[model samples]
Target chain A: GAGVSQSPRYKVAKRGQDVALRCDPISGHVSLFWYQQALGQGPEFLTYFQNEAQLDKSGLPSDRFFAERPEGSVSTLKIQRTQQEDSAVYLCASSLSPPHMYMNTEAFFGQGTRLTVV
Target chain B: SQQGEEDPQALSIQEGENATMNCSYKTSINNLQWYRQNSGRGLVHLILIRSNEREKHSGRLRVTLDTSKKSSSLLITASRAADTASYFCATDVEAYKYIFGTGTRLKVLA
Candidate 1:
């Protein structure tokens, strides 16, 4: 598919466990973003990557949340010692141009990975 | 910490009626975008309005931005059942970062 792709559409894990989610952004995209959406709520920004560099992670709720986009293509979000509050749909999106450009291009989104903590 | 907040958390309207949802932000923004999300699905971009632009339209979707009030409104004309979904407003304050509103759950009854 030409759009962004996310791995493991659904995941279930016990509390205090660890999990990793993967995202494959559109080829040649310069900016990628990760968002978390709780049940019946809007998607909240989690982190952003401009190529291999993590530009911003201010939205990350805690240090337990980590994300990396090594080599500037595929990205991974890892949650260490996942808590019930960490359970939500993780969405990956990519835009063709860098955010600073201030272009009107829209970002493409993936199906997202839903994580459930028991 | 959310920058944008939407009004009428939930709205119900008959199909063919126009639906309007409003969003307000706390700070200055470069651009504001609207997105739709179906149940259990990722968000799909609907429209983007820059701070300098007051209005934009895409097919049946119309967006108006009031920078003076730090607000924006999305109007969907001739709504359909397929339009039933959650609508959110996101403000782009900086590069690659978007602060989203709580969202408005719109239910278009057929």
Candidate 2:
């Protein structure tokens, strides 16, 4: 794809329903990131991936949030037992640099998936 | 937790006037970047400044970094109404991870 792509631009799930959000990064980008943005706030880091490796997930709010990038090119963020607090925009970004580099490069962001848990 | 916090949560300026926003982070960082987002849109990368560098310029945008204070600022010169958007500063605290600030909402009135 020309830029990062996310599926199901908007989602509304009932409480306790499981949801999956997909991200397809630009071809061959080595680093991928997922962020959660609440209304009237900035995007918060959730998890990071280097190639297919899940390197950092310190920001995932709770055990209910999970993300995976099995092929290094595409990623998925899944939320289990959704709660009203889970309503927010989920963003995905990808960069060309790996961890070893200074990572001075910029990452392209997807339009994001807005999840509304009711 | 968010690594950075921005000041002047909301700003309104006349078109053609310069607009500036600041960001301060808590931890050491490799680089700082600014991004713009319109309503219901994805972030658009503006500028990236490496820690070793004091400042950087890209077209109408100027970014400065002060690692000592863990702060950065973005200046948009001769702003246009089209510049109306939210601006966020993201810090690379560690490898492959970026922590974003609360963001500054800039409204450039025409």
Give a tens-digit lDDT track for model 1, residues B36-99: 9998888899998888899999999999999999999999999999999999999987757788
In candidate 2, position B14 carries an lDDT of 95
For residues B14-34, write the lDDT of model 2, one tens digit per residue.
999999899999999887889
lDDT of each: 0.91, 0.91
Docking outcome class, model 2: medium
Off by over 4 Å in 2: A100-103
DockQ each: 0.75, 0.78
* TM agreement with the true structure for every prediction: 0.97, 0.96
Clashing pairs in 2: none
Maximum-DockQ candidate:
2
- Candidate 1, lDDT over the whole model: 0.91
lDDT, residue A59, candidate 1: 89
